[model samples]
Target: MAISAPLNTALRAFAMLLFVVAIAACSRTPNAMPTGVGNLGPGGGAPGSQQEFLVSVGDRVFFETDSSNLTPTAMATLDKQAAWLNQYSNYRIMIEGHADERGTREYNIALGARRASIVVNYLTSKGVNGQRITSQSFGKERPVAICNDISCWSQNRRAVTVVQ
Candidate 1:
């Protein structure tokens, strides 16, 4: 369903708040911020190791329908990521929460937050340090596409686990 304009506005505002907070969280070096926020890939990896954090093998997780609770699939994904993090103890990460463009904007933003936190909690439970994982919700702001179809909407409802 298309979102109501009021809800959309609220969600946009929440997303803006989250964007600002995320920017501030990674504001250590002026140069480091862009690498993390703009390029969700391996932009911050060591030289010649740009592909290090590209979510290769198992680095992120996708959620089921409208729930923030992780399914077995998501659990498995995080288990792999947890193992990866354990293998590389010094690695840090940023869990970006996103929502598909199918619900009220504010509600979607809240759902996104819950989803990201779920992943964060799962990782921490599996031995990854909580401090190293920062969660942010983008609601439906920066969609990869603007289509209203279910195909596009399903893809939009996701939480991307990017390395820092």
Candidate 2:
């Protein structure tokens, strides 16, 4: 087969374009997660790494319908948070309690308070100082997920730990 000059020129241009793209891709570092910025693995790391707390310690824990009791899963998450808090002893935190929109304002506020208290107690038990923590109830006023469905309601019923 004989190759024409114009066809050879086009093939050479296409090959050059592909080589440039490959070089560009290799030079760029992926932003999957910042290096050494987040907790490397589950359970155990020094605090002050905001990325670690948000990604590993998990700032929020969910609860059952109309209940403030901590489930095993919730406890595990709280345990990790407590560990983080203990490591970062100088930091103070606020536990923000929230509720689904299924109850009256007053009722929800009370419920939220209870939930927040439970979280504080658990964290204290896990070696975090009670003095370093405070609690507030948002009731149904603030919700991370807003919808009438169970999925959204479940998300709204949570206690969030805000480190300050």
Candidate 3:
């Protein structure tokens, strides 16, 4: 026997309502941020998260022009980074070295490599495991600032630490 049209229509409407409710139940609220597996510790990020490292400590260190040597300021930043890495032992890091636009491509690559290596050495010396850190040289390929002046060049000459 066939159901009446009105009854059938009501049933379909009820099914649609249930489907919508189910979907809504599974979805997160608009303002809810996605969190990691464990508790959120300091710096407003989950423990060992990139957000934690960046927000609590710093992710980048600046260098002098044509220099791979870490300045006192850069060393200070590295000290913080090393401490963070030691605390967050589960995370691995990549050090990306960059250079100003004034150097030739080959020269810049070498400079950048030196810069990255120096950062890696510093971190390792500070008790961060050497195996957890890797380095790459971007040369003049990536620049946070672009201009023909010291201001921009200073910003470009740096190494950035990325957590993974």
Candidate 4:
């Protein structure tokens, strides 16, 4: 027996729908944020992924223009990060400092390093082990937003926490 053209199209569409459903079903909890403490709790998977860390504990802290100092807002966010770090002692974090596109490459690198160091010091003061944290500067090399305006530059001047 030969299938009709319309039946063949319908079957193909049905198979595609089934594939999509299977993928959706395989997904874990939609609202589940990575606790930063490996999935050793319930799920049998590798340690919490960086994406999860970004979702659960804020991964980036913004800074003012041309400054390495932490603002009150930044400090608040870091406080939360420090608490999370303390709770998940098994995880080590690398803080990355980034600058906007306004300075010479060498200057920007030094500035970025200063920004990252500030964060490390802050976290250390909050009781997070200094040994568990390290910092690097990407300077203006990596930017989250690209534009000549302060608005865009503001987005790029930041310190990001990465789990290792």
Task: List model 2 lDDT by residue over 1-164, tens digit each.
Answer: 98899999999999999999999998766753444433353333343666668866799999999999999999999998988788888788999999999989999999999999999999999999999999999999998888889999999999999988
lDDT to native, each model: 0.76, 0.88, 0.90, 0.87
State the RMSD for candidate 3: 9.0
Selected candidate, larger TM-score, 1 vs 2: 2
Clashes per candidate (backbone, < 3 Å): 0, 0, 0, 0
- Give the TM-scores of the predictions, in the order they appear: 0.65, 0.74, 0.73, 0.70
lDDT of 3 at 60: 93
Rank by lDDT, descending?
3, 2, 4, 1
lDDT of 4: 0.87
Better of 2 and 4 by TM-score: 2
Off by over 4 Å in 4: 1-52
In TM-score terms, candidate 4 sits at 0.70
- Give candidate 3's total backbone clashes: 0
Task: Please give, for residues 48-148, the per-residue lDDT of candidate 3 as tens digits.
Answer: 67787887778999998889989999999999999888988989899999999997999999999999999999999999999998999999999999999
